[model samples]
Target chain A: MNKKINWQYAMMASAFLILALVPLFMSNNYYITILNQMVINMIVVFGLNFITGLAGQMNLGTAGIYALGAYTSALLSRNFGLSPWLTMVAALVVGFLIGRGLGYPSLKMKGVYLSLTTLAFSEIIRILATNLMDITGGTQGIKNIPRFRVLFWNLDTNVKYFYFVWTVAVLLCLLSMRIAHSKWGREFKAVKDNVEAIESLGLDIKKIKIRAFTLAAVYGALGGALYAHFNQFVTSLSFTTDLSISYVIMLMIGGIGNILGNIIGAIVITILPEMLRFLGDYYQITFCTMVLLCAVFLPNGLVSLPGRFRHLVKKKGKGGERFGQ
Target chain B: MEKKRYLSITLAMCLALSALAGCGGGQTPQPSQTQAAGNTKEESQQAGTAGESSNDTAEGASGETILIGVSGSITGAAPINGLRTKQGAQMAADEINEAGGVLGRQIELFVADDGGAQDTAINAANLIISQDVVAQVGPNLSGMALAVEGLLSQAKVPMLTGATSPKLVTTIDNPYLFRIRAADTVQAKLAATYATQNLGCRKLGLFTNSNDYGSGALNVIQEYLDGIGTAYVAEAHNTGDTDMTSQILKLKDAGVDGVIIWTDDAETALAARQFHDLGLDVPIIGSPSISTPQVSGLCQPQWLDNWYCVTDFTASNTSDHVTKFVKDFEAKYNETPELYAATYYGSIYILKDAIERAGTTESDALLKALNETDNLQGVVGKYKPNTMREMVHEGIICKLEDGTAVYLDSITVED
Candidate 1:
């Protein structure tokens, strides 16, 4: 078991090392932008995995929180001329407050009802963003958003933005990994598995759920702020329910409770469509078919593939035991 | 144990099959590439095959190819428009290649579908740009265009799009981006000009969808109306709203002489039907979508009588260039082309012209050539890049007569 754990750690380290050297291998601005986008998406999905995968809460309001963060940061940076870094902090606070406020009331409900409330929350945000023309720029959207700058070094180029985004993504991944192994992570799992038992064990279940939601919101807000600055534009159209669904799908495909799974899911989902672009009209169809196949075949997600393969190999080796069974 | 092995094999088979399918999809463009090569061979034969073969071999040795990227929603909510744009672009590319290509090198088009979503568009832009395209053509929707504008600008790849948002050319102000279609403000002003000056309507009414596209047009029309000191009543309806009775009734009560409807094809049709059913007989002027076949097919044929629209293209135009484009497009695509197809077709020709004039695919050179574009005739109108990089300035007003949009007058904004 110790050897296996070390091997897994080694694999993770190598994977990250390769990711860090990606820019060196592929210096094209376009690929770097895609990588940057994928990293930003991973950050948001990491936060989402905490709520949906660990706490077992069906939070579908991620896009709403993301939009809130993006708009807040964009408005601040555009109007008050705040630094992108400062705007990210402001967005996180706003997201945390909104997430806690919404989570507290909705946590009392379960399953579909909770999902519906969150969906409504997202829809409300979208509608407000569309209707509030003066504040949100209506449909024209907020443009010319300032990029992240540190005294002469502007994070304007794709390569520079890639480093900035990946650094944040790696730090957040570490934070999420810590949370997943901590006592709070266990409490989250307990709430997901058996809420009544968790409550009986003298734990504040509502508080645990709210904390999970708040953390998810903070990550989402951070991701959104990074995205707004990186893209240098924000439109309400970017924050639709379709995006929220994509995040949920990524979390599911990656394996809900696994941090590594989230990273894998983000990479595959973000890059697959791009790779399939040569398919012309059949691009979306092929992407959807592949995703469906993954869902149907890998019930526990892609993370379980190696274990399943190993189980198969072991079973094949034990011929006499198979005959006896 | 047998079950585990079986499941493992099944999963492996699925992965392998998907991998094959992905590769198959990636190779879909290879057939087109070969066709382009075959065309070049024929052209070489016409230009003295002996001498051409030597030049071709020399060129092949150098392995020079100029790639231009085309991005649009080829398979999503607005697939028809996207496909039309793609078809137009592809036709332009084929023609350019047949004419011995651009700058003594074949033009290779890298087309990608954006699926009409912001995220997908970004990916499409990234994918095309990764292939090292000299410039890009589309991502037809306004929202998708806005999303990828920054990426293209950063990469220093000039793009010409048919997306009609005024902000696409003005507010964002990406130096590398140019718009082929008239902006929404231009269309709105045209509608305003036609309704007030031609129809002689004093009190105008506005019926706008509450979404970005509709509201954006509404704001622009209001601005134009305000500049002319015209009084008007305005009401907005949300998307997925089938009922416009309340809004129509409000406009009727306001005693407006004409109603300017700003919405998509289906919604515009619905609003016009509702207005007719409500016995409001005012002259109806709408955005370009109101002139589409989809709208005409949806609304009562009689309801469309005398309805006017401000559009960038109408097949009824008698200009030799427009006639030629209509003839060629119909012969090629086996269907009458719409605004998007015409505008995108024009965009490619404009790009080809720019590339030819610049004499190189360098970004700065192409941008300069594009900025200096003057009186370049297209199916739509005379092309010229203004200070804002808006290539098309004039809009055509078309009237619906017996389910067909008839070109009535051309409206041009003074420089």
Candidate 2:
């Protein structure tokens, strides 16, 4: 319950710096570009960690929200007269409103019910993106998305895109950390742990849930905006049910309830395919096998690995209380 | 357990990274380079007329690296055609490179899989763009190409794709977007002209799948018919739709003289089967999508009777490039390359010629060079740009008979 500059943050910063230097070491520009994409996914995953990890509210509509953000920025900058900067702001605002609307329904739903509602909400958004040819450009998609540039850094180069995505990611990481340590963060945890008990405290559980949803949407939208500029195009296919499921699984694999875990999960999943390229068609099978193994055996995910290692080291003296402690 | 897991994870990571590192740099030379090196080298050498023609390419930038990007559905349902295009492009690049690299620079190709989606096509385009390709060969499908058109057009990167729609070529006036294949209107006009003028068929019944490709071709066909004041019967079906009994029944009731099939895959063949089951003796006229072997494989062999198809790529072409490309492609991929692959392959070669002629990767130079290309003896067919804003030229037409698409005739826009 204390705000501390912990070992976890140190590990995350180290990982961030190492990932930032990946493009430099790799001979293949293709992988370097793929790594740049992984960082973008990390941005979205970190946001997912906010609602799913800290708040314990399961929203599987990250892809929809991500698409909303991307399309919003794309439409505004390309169709309207607004610059990409203002378009991003519009994306966040719209994303927050949509998230809140979807979240408000969750007040009546609980657990899997809420998850289903979010899933349905994502599907509905996807259908609209596909069917509405006049507005969203239908399945043909909105094209000519502007390249991203922030603080005078043009994201045209692989290294530059990497820097920009990571800069935003790190900033989002710090912000989420700060918020997770705040009082509102504790209320979110309280609502997650026991809604009835939190209701008895009269702390307004519904309000906290909505806030968490809005926060998650804001993160998703920001990531989507980054994706739009990075890819320079927005279409319905980019945000599918698979992408939505991947976000949740990414959260789980990285370690639920751990900030660093989200980053690790994002990197692992994102980099896994690229790493498996040597196996060719067999690589996907191996990758799936590894993920399944982790899910079944290491259900606590990669985040708990370090703690488990520490526990084993100390368990030499005392063995019984290992899991409980 | 934790230490073992840690060590295992570390070992796993190292093994995976090393595996990836090993696979990193070994990709086949892309379409542009293969065409430039392989085809040109053979033609440009040997103190003869071919050598003199090769000298034209040799005089320019001859060893400079020109990277061209091609994005298509390489691993998805459309992989059959996508792989062929990739091969064709690569072969063209190899030939061009061997002939003495374009502008003294060897052409390199960077291809990405679109997975048959507009977003993926756009992603593939961006991936290629980040790697700094001079031109792009495809984002194969009309919808996918439309999605990425803005980026390529804005970047002023010329995209020479065998896209089938007039919409793709109309999106910009930037001269960067050029179609190697004929637009929909060209195919429609050819079909209409042939159906009415040559075949002496009248009172036609049309069965078309419900997609942009089908609808666009149908519209053009109908427009051509209307210009001739011909009243025709029509019906519509959807993609992936196997049952065409309802549409066929309606068309049969219309007392049609002949039937025209406008569809892309299984659905086209399904319509043919439905027509036959009903014992309808309607002479079948199919759109270009009906020319692929998959369509014939889907329908009964008897369906070939009175069944005619119009397409830009002739499976029966005896042209040197066409013959060699088809031979090489079949030898390598172990399958008869379809029109999609032929057009795509031709697009890659067309791009190589443009880039080489332009002598630089500058968008304007490439656009001008592409626009100036006249009577280019391409593998798909001869190409001559309209020099207009659209850059859409008339496409040649071929008719299918006995499983082979024989070159029936050609059409050019009248001055």
Among these predictions, the greatest DockQ belongs to 1
lDDT of 2 by residue, B26-89 (tens): 3322333322222334322311121112211312221345666777666545666666676667
Cα RMSD of all models vs. native, in order, equals: 5.9, 7.7
Model 1, residue B310: displacement in angstroms? Answer: 0.8
DockQ of each: 0.22, 0.15
The TM-score of candidate 1 is 0.88
Output the worst ten-in-a-row residue range by lDDT, candidate 2 chain B. B47-56
True-structure lDDT of candidate 2: 0.70
lDDT of 2 by residue, A1-325 (tens): 2212345655676677666656667734456656667788888887787778877888888888998998899998988868888999999998899878877987888779878888888877777776565677644566667776667766676577778788888898888888887987788787778888887877887788888888889889988998887766676756777788888888888888677888888877876654543232244468778989988877878978866887877876476566558
Q: Which candidate number has the best lDDT?
A: 1
lDDT of each: 0.79, 0.70
Cα lDDT, model 1, residue A290: 90
Candidates in order, TM-scores: namely 0.88, 0.74
> For residues A85-121, what per-residue lDDT tens digits would candidate 1 score against the true structure?
8998999999899879877865679888888888889
Give, for candidate 1 chain B, the lowest lDDT window spanning 10 residues.
Answer: B52-61
